[model samples]
Each structure stands twice: as C-alpha cells, then as structure tokens.
Target: MQTPFKLSLSAQDIACERGGRTLFRNLDFAVEPGQALLVSGPNGAGKTSLLRQLAGLLPLAGGRLVTDGADADTPIAELSHYVGHLNAAKTAFTVRENLAFWADFLAEGQGDPADHLAGALAAFGLGELGRLPAGLLSAGQKRKLALSRLFAAPRPLWLLDEPSVSLDVASVKKLDGAMRDHLKAGGIAVVSTHVPLETKFTHTLDLGLERAA
Candidate 1:
C-alpha cells in the first residue's frame, strides 16, 4: 500500500513531451472569476496536453500549480468543468436523463436541481426531446446535449476543447450565446478551437505559433 505523489491542482511553466518529441514549454496562464481564456493553436500544438495539466489528468514534468487563486491560479478540477472531445453518457438514457445525471452529480446546494434542468432544456430548445434517448438524437442534437452540461453544473471555470465541431449554424449561435452568458456570470473559460469564435472577448492566447523542437 503506497500513497503516490500527486501533482498540484493547477500549473504554471507547464510543458509536455510525447514520443520523445517536445511539444512546448514555459507556458503560464490562469483562470479567474469572470474572465475567459481562449487557447488557439494549430493541430498538435499541445493544447490538449496543456488542458490535461490543468485538469490534473497528467503529471507535469516541471512546474508549480495551485488552486488558491494565488498568483492567479486555481485547481482546474475545482474551478472549472473540462469538456473534452469525448462524450460519455448512457446513450440509452433519454436526453433529459443525460442532463439530469450531470445536474444531480454537480448539484450539492449550489442551485436547485430542477431549475438547472429546466433552464438547460428550455435554453437549448430540448424541451420536446427531453425523453428521447441520446442515441436517437441527430449529430447536432447530440452536440447540443453535450453543451447542456455547462448550464446544469455551476463551476467557476470551464475548459472546452473544440466545442464547435459538428454544430450547425443555429446550434453554434446557441452555443456562443450560452458561453457568453457563462462569461457574463463571472465564470472563466478556456477553449481550444480552430474555428473563429464569435465571442467578443479581447483576451486570448494563440498557441498556434508555438514552435515545436
């Protein structure tokens, strides 16, 4: 029985190496209440790895990470919701059930569970499809289902990776609006995308130019 060494909650000077290839290094960023950060980079630029560090899913080779809002950093797992490219839900569960699962998981006296569910369903135009199993939904509908988690769970920060993929124009608008509302509510978000976001935020970090050695 051994208690392994665990990394910090958040990281500065984050770097990663895969397959003996250096991705990038000396990265510094933080998430704050009411602030949103967009991580823009070319494919294979370590955007996901950077997020992994923040999410505490990967061990940092070197750096200091924190969650106390000290030096403007916080534990990503505690401060934000990380939405990766994969969606793992009981596809057989109805759309409402899917949301309800998350709503229930993250609902610990923050907001009323029912209110969050209603807001998510109505806000995303899924009121009629609430009972439909997620597997039966269209691609765009599934994407919407995926996006609904943001509203159901209240976190101070958000780590979204390529949220615009497979989304139609209307759904995209809805997604953008939801994100805008999230930012307006004093929540911080870090998003990675190749598509030009319609968001009006002036603060963004472009990792696309980071040269790999």
Candidate 2:
C-alpha cells in the first residue's frame, strides 16, 4: 500500500504577465488535501497562465507558490499531473501505447502498471479503442484518453485547464467523477474552466473580475 501523505498548496501575492501586459496580480488562494480550486474567467483573463505557473511550466512573474506537507525538495511539476488545453497524445501511437507510455513515464514509483492502465482505459470509456490509433479518434475521444493519465499515475496535485473541452455531457460527468475521486483520495486540484463542475468541495477564484478592478 502507498504511504499516506498530507498535501497542501497555496499562492500568495501572485502575479503574471504575457507580452509585457499584466494579466493578473496579487492573486492568493490555498487548497488542502481533499479540496479543489476552480479558476474561472473570460478569454485572455490569464486562467491558463495561472495553471501553467502552478504546474511549473511557466515562470511566475511575481509572488510565491508553495506546496506543503510533502517532500520540500520535490518540485510541483513532479508532484502534479497537468492536463492542458491540448491533448498531449502522440497521434501515431495507438491509444493503449499512448496511455502505457504515460503510465510508465509518470509512474513516480507508484501503482501497478497493468492495473493502472486497465483502470484508466475503463475510466475514460476507452477500453474498446485501446488498440486504435490515436490519430483516428474524435476530439472527445482524444480528450478522454489524455485525461486518463490522471488515473494511470497517482499525483497529489492536478492542474487542469479547460479539462471539459470537447467533451459531451456524459464524458463531462466522467471527468467530474475522476476529479471527485482524486479529491476523496486526498489530492488537490486547481482547475481552469468555463463549464461548471458540480462538486461540493470546490473553491472559486474569478481572475477576470478580481483583476479587472
């Protein structure tokens, strides 16, 4: 069994800029285990930028982002599963191959390979298309496959940007279930989306209105 670990994340006095234009500044929020932060805003409001910064993909223009109750030395990128707007799948690879690669690449010494792969495929309703080439999948199917990576690896933090994009109502519900399960397992998530995710343990951060004023 995996050892239990406490997880917490916070951003203090955060600021971000793109092309010399400030998107948001002085943003602050905190999320503990079993909790989620829902980031909502209009286009160009820096919702994606915030998630990228938290994922350690983009540099923080200003402020401190902290992760507590875990190994202090481990970077946020290593502890997080960042699902961006684009589906990070290899078009040439089969669905199973793409998922298998992620399962091993992001394993971080946790979860059984076979079990996690199977569970992820099933979770996204992609079991039957496992052998099909990813390039052939519909947009929704590719999104599902991309999201399945969260199930294939156990990460304490999830950084999602418009995760429900290209998904149907049923698939959206499945994504919600995945997020719910992640939170229940003591994982923290920061999601940037326009779609409302019906969950009881979510906190909202409206970058558009907050930053405009």
Please report the candidate that would top TM-score against the real structure. Answer: 2
* TM-score for all models, in order of appearance: 0.85, 0.95
As for candidate 1, its clashing pairs are 10-65, 34-186, 41-208, 67-75
> Which residue runs does candidate 2 get wrong by more than 4 Å?
1-5
For candidate 2, what is the lDDT? Answer: 0.87
39: Cα error in model 2, Å? 0.4
Candidate 1 regions off by >4 Å?
1-11, 68-75
Best of the candidates, lDDT? 2
Q: How many pairs collide in each candidate, listed in order?
A: 4, 0
> For candidate 2, what is the TM-score?
0.95
